[model samples]
Target: MAPNFSDLVEEARLSLQALVDYGDQLFNPTVRLGVTGLSRAGKTVFITALIHGLLRGGRFPVFEAFATGRIARARLAPQPDDAVPRFAYESHVRTLVEERQWPHSTVDISELRLVIDYQRPNGADRTLTLDIVDYPGEWLLDLPLLAKSYQEWSAESLKLSRQGPRLPLAAAWHAHLATLDPRGRADEQETLTAAGLFTDYLRACRDERFAMSLLPPGRFLMPGGLAGSPALTFAPLDVPADGSAPDGSLWAMMARRYEAYKDVVVRPFFRDHFARLDRQIVLVDALAAFNAGPEALHDLQAALAGILDCFRVGRRTFFASLLRPRIDRILFAATKADHLHHASHDRLEAILKRMVDRAVTQAAFAGAEVDVVALAAVRATREVRMRRGHEQLPSIVGTPLAGEVANGEAFDGSTEVATFPGDLPTQPDGLFSVPADSGSFKGLSHFKGLSHGSADQADYRFLRFRPPQLDNDGGDTPYLPHIRLDRALQFLIGDRLT
Candidate 1:
């Protein structure tokens, strides 16, 4: 079959953009860096802290360019896309640094461009644009939808919903599905009601307690400005395996809207935002998965795998990627290392590596460089030693966020206290094991149990701490405290400077 004209036109447009980018690079060098993570993964903090650190010329022994004084200065410039919202860096940083409160989560895709001026060995000054793009991880989960038809998505979603932890939450949505007849004529009210129920089910599964990572139609959770639009109003149906939707039928209506979502919501994002990246960072809230138990852990792994598939991880020419951009380097980071003691930081990185092992393998095999790091973009706590009876316990001292509880005691957000966070397993696979009785989700049986203390127990005492106060010089910006951020910078853009 011959290719469609619209497909050809899109290919040509993308290729032209790539050629333009290539031509611009002749005089102006730039790197598009993508920042994303699941809800509460601290994407905002990472970006804010990274910028603050560079602008302040912070002490970073690992980031060679900055540490060695080769990089003269880093400053923000006008972002490339005027249509896209600029990342609220100043506001977010002030809240995190001065007010000691966490910033708001990202609901829509935003952009920020940083121009770094560095001194060269040849006595010349050089500069490059670091374009940071931020978006919700929920949206990334929808990448898989491109490869699936409406019927396929419905069947798979139903299967996933029927499993552990999700079954109870999906009760209402399931009830609504049971009442609907796919072959019946499409009714506007019925369509809206089903979408509402299904959306509710997705939200319920993502409650803080569960922290599920596999939810799709990502707009359902962080709809941005698309809330209530027909593009966001479709839900899966129980269409028979071989069923065909007659025009004006409920199934037909849903299928049509699903296609529109892919065209309007998914494709544009993939082309304009995601696919163009030169390097990327995927932040993971690993601690949340531990708290949510084994099922959530498995879901996170699957989500990462699905997301990995979306990245074109390989060595490709600019022309090749103008058609389909290939990410040259990708970093998967375990965020919120401050939630645990310093000793567990390595363990956290190891566990994150295990979680994305398969995806990492795929990326590396395709010739892309990949790394995993455990970091707190903004260090929110300090290590303390507490003498308890005969044992000196390692603890973290920080102000707990208001209403945050420890041992049934609530914090006022201003009182500082030391609390002993529980230990993580010495080995990584402990979190991947699935017990014999958990014959629930597919491919999950291959998981090994996450032994909280031993090889047999499962637990993680994940806690929330308020952002720490900085002894600032009263400048417009100050260096934000962080863990392993220098190493992350080295991996992300070190080569570009060299």
Candidate 2:
């Protein structure tokens, strides 16, 4: 019999491994970054901009030596390691260049890898491989819950259904499930029926997309066709009452599925990928929360608390080859600072600091450090002079949608429009009662506004993220020119010292 294709491929791998081992031993550090945020948080734009800034080795005010701070050098060349995944850089680049438009919202988890070469402060040259993973912001919330049993998780979900803001869909699903007799024989029909209603609620979430940040199976929802997959069909855990056994009940079956989900989906992702992170960058859209209703505001706080629990470093395993959880620094960046003016950027940063102050304080026991910053990935609008005497001010010269009116004229979408304030702060103590303004939302309009902007250019769009920062002794201080990647690098991984 002829040698099979699989056999040929296995033979090739052996041959390649032998040749590749001949090179000088190269050290590889897998820095897994989790770019997390609420629904509209500007993760895609921030990542895209970070990649662009790193690639462009020139003077950048928001980046350290790119302009002044430190005398340094930079360059971007083809990455060597085939295992390092490639970011959709070319496609994203084309979205701006070819389409002359913002790219569609990042709907699922996409991985990108790049090798950035630079000379350290000690004059030694090195190549740092960055393995970047971008996933839907909402899925991050599900990470912590993976450790819980289905009964425990289901009970919590049931509790949350009655209390959390705007969880009508989840509430209705639970109400329908209550009608079924849990103690009866496994009625596949009734179970499937209840599951169908719950699935509908999940589907509704996908359809609106921007309404609430509480997304279900976030990665799966974006593609829509994955609903049939077993991984996406998990039911919330339902704990038994009377302190008695409910094994062999419908709830038990669903609980089993939930366990499978945690074992098959969540554990591997964390142990193999997430548990080894060296750095984290959490993107926050403080302004967006202030603009949303009280319910959203409350939900945001609960969501943050849940996500931060993961960073509190648990026990370390010897056999895993994992680095002891040394991720000491965490940067909570308030993205889309360009939407406001320079004066208000600090205020925006301050607001974020205030909002997450409790979260940081709680996680401090794990050696995690925290900082808040206001940033813009792409500086779409520039502040120009309103009068002859003053200096140029930040302004945008684009259409609202192709044909929308602003200050009259034919609205050619070419005239420069002023962008005031600067950065936006987190909601102040009394922001809820601040009274409605023209831009404030009354009902569902808030969700509409969130879905309507680009990274830096959008009139009203911000992103939230929570990726681990690179851990190093010197990676604690905040970076100067806080908007760019070089600044992020200084704060997240500056031990290289060059």
Candidate 3:
């Protein structure tokens, strides 16, 4: 389709902004790095740990610029955007280091700036400004809505909700949807009820057991300050995909609100924040999907594909920078590597690589540097070996969060235990295949007593662990332990530092 007037106008405005930004960059080199992931993907922890490691000089052997003494100093700087909230790095660090508790998840968009003074290989000193833009990945899923009309989106959403695990979760919403007539007069209360039920359905899909990831209209799940606003109080109705709504009908009302949501919520975010990113890192809690089963993994794969489609990815040149900025480097990190033993980390990375293969291929073809790594931003567990009937079993030792239960034992927050974290399938392909009779949901139950290649269903027992205890010696900043975080750093911004 040809670009609409609004689309052309948006491109023009983006070009103007890029020109201004490029002019500023001539005097001060900066990289706008966007950090995002779906709910509970450890985005908050990842950002906090990355900044803390740089500022406090945590060990990062793989990050060559930092490890080789090329980085002279790193410090927090005032973020450029005054309107966005500054990420609470101090409080988050305190929560992890002092209290030994994981910080809260990201609920809104925030930004932080890190200024690193480094020496080039030739001994020339240079300063690089890093602007980390943190936001919910759910917002990225909404970008596709820009090209979808209200009728088309409604039809697709309704059809998707009727399938797989979503079928049962969306029962209430579906029941309500059945009675609503698209041609009927617009009624506010009815619309409110439909919206509420729809939101509840989305919430249920995100449950630990299901771990479904393809839920869209992202604002519905994380409304933030937009709660109760008309822009957010609309739901997908049973309407004809190719038909036009009559004036003042319920369908028309819904179509108007849907358009308003795109205009007021999604478009502004794209125009103001997303379009300006020079680099991006998408965090993924693939372990959660492993525990949830194959359906969840499939949904996650689809969600990832949608996310890649939204990125303005391409090779950035001098002329391109002044006209339209493109995200040239993207790192997809499978988070929570500490949940698994070291032996399985490579297998986990392989699984994620397989999941993102198609999307990464497309992004790479478009000139973006794409790579996948399995990492724990903040290592919560340490590797250990446990004797199980004379056989040595590779295990991990960590304090499970209060109320976390495993093998019929509930752990208190203070008690440490060693658990045999299960092995991942060496061949990642087995994880993607679905058994014919496993049914649509095929949650944890379906995997029971079944072996998918070398790994059985029981090989993915991932429990939530509390942050590691930091030794505070005379108030000196303690080093945070991480698995493969340096590798992630190298892929994300190593070239820029050099």
Candidate 4:
């Protein structure tokens, strides 16, 4: 007799507990953080940096205070292969350190766990477990379409085909669908032709790499299965005018299938896996949009609109917030801030915040709390001095790799400087407070113009980002990273921390 799926799930769940149980309870809270981003956003770097921070026991200066605050202790422990399995942080670290190269971007869903022992404010020793999971950004768009059907999907896709360069391919598929007799006995040959056409349309979408807000997983459209099978066959029809209009129009059949896809595929995954998440970090690549031309910007907006819609849980005013089980706090972070000079880091965050603010507001109106943070997952450069006509500013200097060049262009952020240079100044609190020696920081100036990568190679540049500054009420801070971590813990998992 074979083991039932439930039994297997139970065993896996039990195995995960051992891994989850490694941290000290009072100081460390069991928290789950979701890492998500658009196709080329630096989620990998963010995750890698986070793992490095934890592994080094918060030795990294970036998170030094956070490691000590509310967290009296921190450590790395063995993780289990249960659940989705831990993220291969060590493997990524080796790639970055041993090979002196950045880790390749993620292609599929992956998971990693970091167990930290900490001391909470109340003087209790506790263990905090951070479970990080990553998935392809492309797959995220499909969440909305889980509610859509084959016919609906097909019709919508068909419409997309008419616009841009996608029209000819879609027209061919539409012509094929037009020939097939929907009312006639389902002819395998006709169905096969339609599926083939559908597959072609999907392929075209993939090839164009259009930032579509919704797409069924590519695998589903081009399944390695029998042709004309029920899985590949979809009938997308429109909603009828009459309430009782059940006469199987292509729309009705498609609608039914769409609902089935949701019930069978999307809903189960959310209910079983995603809903359990406690924290989420959404990574955005704003630079990509500014460079992709107007269409890409529109696509970015559309994608943001779609992503925000997911957290819009309920309809009612009072009861809805209480009833909707959201992942609590969502962090919308601009990834790869490392690529730009420090001077423009806030501007990048502001740009992203401006771009997604409306959608975020709408999501909040529907009942989810969201905040934006600017982050660089990997640190690629060091602060440098720049001077221009007696004005100096804090800037980063590094020998950028050849591949870091964008759009077949090469511009260096380096400069020849005199022997005596002033020490790096503190980050400005408010916008536009020029340091007294802005004139001396000549080598630290940022580029004024925007640069973008072409379609062929995305995620090629090393992103340098400005880290978020914490508001201190003039207290002597012994540990910086621990304080940030504690604040984050308080906001995200404090209730569970104690």
Task: Say which candidate scores most in TM-score.
Answer: 3
TM-score of 2: 0.71
TM-score per prediction, in order, is 0.93, 0.71, 0.95, 0.65
State how far residue 11 of model 2 sits from its true place (Å). 33
Q: Candidate 1: TM-score?
A: 0.93
- Model 2 over residues 33-81: C-alpha lDDT tens digits? 6665765567776776666555644335544434443434334335434
Candidate 3 CA-lDDT value: 0.88
Give the per-residue lDDT of model 4 (tens digit) for 1-498: 356675466445533543343323334556666777766687776777666654554344333335446555455566633646556777876666545455776666677777766666668676767777786665566676655445456556655556553556467777776665444443455555665666677565544244332345433542433244454466332332233223554444444544555655555545545554556777787655444333444556667767766653333222332333345577777765555566566666665676577887776675556777666655454555556447564545444443334445554433211111122113322212323213232222332333233223333323332222323445432112221222323344445555
Q: Each candidate: RMSD to true structure?
A: 3.7, 10.6, 3.0, 11.1
Please give, for residues 1-498, the per-residue lDDT of candidate 1 as tens digits: 255676577667767767777777779999999999999999999998888888877667899888888998899998789889999998997898778899999889999999999987667889989999999998888987876789989988998899888999999999989999998999889999999999999999888888788899899888868888999999999886556799889999999999999999997988788877889999999888876767888888888888888888887575575566678899999999987889889988988899889889989999999999999998988988777668776778888789876445677898987767756677777556665226543332333322123323422345688998778678766668889999999999998887
Comparing 1 and 2 on TM-score, the stronger one: 1
Candidate of highest lDDT: 3
Question: Which 10 consecutive positions of candidate 4 have the poorest summed lDDT?
Answer: 416-425
Q: What is the TM-score ranking, best to worst?
A: 3, 1, 2, 4
Model 3 Cα shift for residue 356 (angstroms): 0.9
lDDT of 4 at 313: 35
Superior by lDDT: candidate 3 or candidate 4: 3
